[model samples]
Target: MHRDIVYASPTAGGEQRDLRLDLQIPRTKGPKPLVVYITGGGFMTANKAGNLDERTYVAEQGYAVASIEYRTTTTGSTYKDGVADVKSAIRYLRAHSAELGIDTAKVAVWGQSAGGYLAAMAGATSGTDRFEQGDNLDQSSDVQAVVDQFGVHDLAKVADDFDPETKATYMAPGSFINAYVFGPNSARTVVTDHAANRAANPATYLNRSSAPVALLHGDNDHIISPSQSLILLDALTRKRVEGTRYVVKGADHGDLPFLPDPEAGRKWTTQKVMGTITRFLDRELRS
Candidate 1:
């Protein structure tokens, strides 16, 4: 376990902040594939150690898991800033692959909710220079695969898919989208900011060369509708990109069934869910 490893120091609002990652490497013989995990906090806050147990379980399966920190609304940052931070972390891992025992050729990004959105952005915009800011310019930020769980793919249409109550809250002032994308006080909501919403949409950057994506969403998710994944899947199919979708029955935004039972001292994910993710990652990164 490597804790608080500084990956980049990007200047924001005339002040520099250190971005770090907590890494767990398997006790394998050679360098292992890397799975970068991004935590979810409604794009407002982030903690690298949020899902340590799940990451450790992935590491135990002969892979290196890196839980990364990205700038969020609490840091006065936006979606673009978050994507830049994620790409910078990827470049940093590749640059320091030898010392970190990471297999530079095989890397994937996995995230839940807001993190999932960032992962989709990173995968869709691979080889593009739009958000490749920070150090390690020589190393590419292209990921082999992406695992997005209950991510908001299209901000423009996301609110429409939500229930009436959820939509009302999402469109209200100082909502998550308002604070994270536009300024906290900005009158622009996801409904009014069509251009900004399009800019932040992962589907806007999808191409034939984009990384293969595996999307998982809960059917009972009210915060982020299951239609979000369907929209992304439709985009992936349009581009002829390899894509897979999974709908977890009877799961909520970030609640039981998907997460492990804490009372049982289990890891972050359940055995069945983790197995599904592992197989997809193995097919993309190990095969």
Candidate 2:
């Protein structure tokens, strides 16, 4: 269902890693739309195989889907490096579109939790320079749409509110975002680096030409406050860009359905989420 490839040369660590992605192709002959799905681990630890069941479901819907890999901050990779790796992944995939049986031009980047931030970055910075890294520079790394599930929109805001006194920190030293901004090991001062976080936030990059984005967030997401989505919604509205969010009521971080019982008809189901996503993708990518 997938293959591995070294998309880049040796990193600053002098180790050339074999970054891999799972590519699932439908039986259709012609090139199909691509969904590059990213997994979330708060930027600390996670991989391409994190969300297998969901991605396979998308692939079954007549598309060439990919679950991509990116270096995490826990491995000494910076926030910029992670985004660059994602951009490079997109570029590498597009470069080999013919081989992968994918429609290079109709790609969507999708992710959950922290990966949601990466997916948003992929869509927001499409034509922008600076984030692109590694090989396959000729192919465009832009994605048509972004499907983010509970990713933070403003890092600085979160860091600012994350225990201003340092005693009540929302993010511990082991958190990947802290590693991203302050290296793998962090000082108390690193949590309050407002300026740095502001500079790298996705909200700072939004514009009229930014690709359409759809966010699915639990209203009661304890890990990432729903306020993050509100901030993004406000920014997107102000920018006059096409963006929307689905707030799953009474839902927490790991719960897909808002209700306590799956049999309850009052909450969202896996099929409901997929239907929303597939319909949005079709409206944005299909004719």
Model 1 C-alpha lDDT per residue in residues 169-231, reported as the tens digit of each score: 887767887777786577887678788888889998988668999998878776677899999
Model 2 scores worst on lDDT over the 10 consecutive residues at 256-265
**Which numbered prediction scores highest in TM-score against the true structure?**
1
Candidate 1: misplaced stretches above 4 Å?
Answer: 255-268
Residue 151 displacement (Å), model 2: 0.8
Give the Cα lDDT of each candidate. 0.85, 0.74
lDDT (10s digit) by residue, model 2, range 10-58: 2734466667777889887799998888887777665776656677778
Clashes of each: 0, 0
TM-scores for candidates 1 onward, in order? 0.93, 0.88
